[model samples]
Target: MTIQIKICGLSTPETIAASADAGASHIGFNFYPPSPRSVAPELASELAAITPRSLLKVGVFVNPDDTLLNEAVRHGALDAIQLHGKETPARVQEVKASFGLPVWKVLSVETDEDIAAADAYSSVADLILFDTKTPKGALPGGMGMGFDWSLLDAFDKSIPWGLAGGLNSENVADAIRATGAPLVDTSSGVESAPGVKDVDRIAAFCKAALDHD
Candidate 1:
């Protein structure tokens, strides 16, 4: 099976080009100001401009209002919007309706109940991304913390879904095997430090996810 790969939290032109050159299907631009990987819409637009047309540009936001969303979409020319905060299904629908772009809803998974909650967004969200839940005061994702992969064994797969959290070149193949994830996402796992992406790691990660059966 061909697995799609998303390299998240990309800010610079070099890393964005690296992700696209390494065969990534999507590239994520973080808009959450508190996160280490955050970037303004103008910078994201510059980075997005160099991205190849084959790859989708995804804007990552957390509890964003219409103004931010409008600015990001208009400036960044995003192909999709990824909600990584406390947005409900209604909000997901509203974002989709307003932007006319595919919406990806991130679910912070720690238990079977978290996986089950995806049902609520099956109809509204274009895709459901399962990521690990961080600490109370920590960033929403890209902390390189993974949840129990077995928790997804019994997932109903009501809609298109992807796997995220703690994925690196060393463990992504195993993760794909464990959950049969159609798509795999990573940010910190491919970074040398918080928000610093490594080109070699980016290439290795995409290779690993693509080579997996």
Candidate 2:
């Protein structure tokens, strides 16, 4: 099966180019200001301008208001919206309706209950992204943490979903084989430092994910 790959938290032009050149199906830009990966809407637009239309340009937000969403969509040239916050199903549907764009809801997971929680978004979100749950007071994601992959063994596949958190070049193949995830996302895993993406790792990660049988 072909596994879709998303290289998220990209802020630099070189790394963005590397991600596209490496065959990433989606490119993500952070809109949350507190995160080191965050970029202004104008800069996001310039970075997105280099992306091929065939590839998805995702704007990652954390419980964003309509104003932020509007600016990001307009200036960032986003093709999809990734809600990586505590947005409810109603909010997801609202964003989809308001922006007329595909919405991806991120569900942080640690156990079976968290995995089961995804059912609530099946009808609301265009896609569901299962990421590792963060510790209290920590950032939402991109901390290089991973939950037990086995927790997803009995997950419902009615909704289109993707796996995130702690994925990298060395382990993405195993991750894909383990959960049979159709899509895989990465951020810190391809970074040289906090918010500093490494081009070689980006290429390697894409290679590993695509080369997996």
Candidate 3:
């Protein structure tokens, strides 16, 4: 099966172009202030216009209320909402109902046990993002930390899941092979530094995912 790729944490228009030109299926713009990659809603809107219609624009939020979420969707023209914080299943349903777009639920997985939480969102989420769990008091993701890929060993079920947190050109193929993840996402992995996306690295990562084993 073909792998879907997403380049996340994009802040500027140049980075958004690089991701789109590199064949990314989705581009993620963060609204969380805690994230160094965060961009203002106005910038997000400007960058969103540059994206091709074929590419999906996703807005990342952290426990955002209706006003912020509405403003974000209004300005960014987000095709999807990625709730990376403590939004419950009911919240997910509300966001979906409100925005009328696909909603992605990001789950931090450390062990096989964490996979159980998927059930809570399976019905509501259009897609699930699996990322490495950070330490207490830490940000939700974009830490560049990798979990044991083997921990996903027992997760073989329906729903298209995307692997994230620590993936680059070198390891993405292996990550896909190991986890059977149909989609792979990267933020810090394809960057020269946190929030600084390397254009060449972005192209290389897209190539790596499409190349043979």
Candidate 4:
């Protein structure tokens, strides 16, 4: 029950309220416009202000330049920045320095070779998020697709990492048991539709994540 649960891609006030009510430890705001879940920085700021201090705020981006990241930090009270793109270790260092916020580096995992990049980010990332790789023509993360759980079997990683992609109320515990992830993330998994978060599903997902610990 010690694992952290992050409910990503929250847009509406109703869902934001449900996120804390459901006992989620963290809430994520997507900055990528292409994503159906994307919310404006001003709207994110409004949501963050109302969010309980007990819930941490995470800002998601995809290889964004410094300007957009700075704007999010200035407007939305983000406690962490989730780099869900092809950002290098050097960029990770730069983001941490420039924003003065804890940085999370997300690595799309498909095979054992993908785990090698973990070492490269180990020294800099506050946390490493392992998301299932997107299809040939899809967004990077939050594609509502999952990888084989056995792929993460016996993954003895040195850095702290989270498991994401296609995880929901039914499969989160099994995913955690297989990957030994210290954290669990959700987006489309808890949605009634694309970008629409379901409060009940959010609660169920959180319960499953906590039970795994």
Candidate with best lDDT: 1
Per-residue accuracy of model 2 over 41-98 as CA lDDT, tens digit each: 9999888788776568999999999999999999888999999999999999999999
How many pairs of residues collide in model 2? 0
lDDT of 1: 0.94
Sort by lDDT, top down from the best = 1, 2, 3, 4
Q: How big is the positional error of residue 80 in model 2, measured in Å on the Cα after superposition?
A: 0.5
What are the per-residue Cα lDDT tens digits for candidate 3 across 90-198?
Answer: 9999999998999999989898888778888999999988899999999898888989888776665577688996898989988888888888999988889877889
Model 4, span 158-181: residue lDDT tens: 667788889999999988887778
Segments in model 2 whose C-alpha atoms lie over 4 Å from true places:
none
Query: Against the true structure, what is every candidate's RMSD?
Result: 0.8, 0.8, 1.2, 1.4
Model 2's TM-score against the true structure? 0.98
Q: Which has the higher lDDT value, candidate number 2 or candidate number 3? A: 2
Tally clashing residue pairs in candidate 3: 0
User: Candidate 4: TM-score?
Assistant: 0.95
lDDT of 1 by residue, 1-213 (tens): 889999999988888889889999999999999999999999987887788898899999999999999999998899999999999999999999999999999999999999999999999999999999998998999999999999997787647999999999999999999899999999999999999999999999999999887
Q: Which whole-number lDDT from 0 to 100 does residue 212 have in model 2?
A: 88
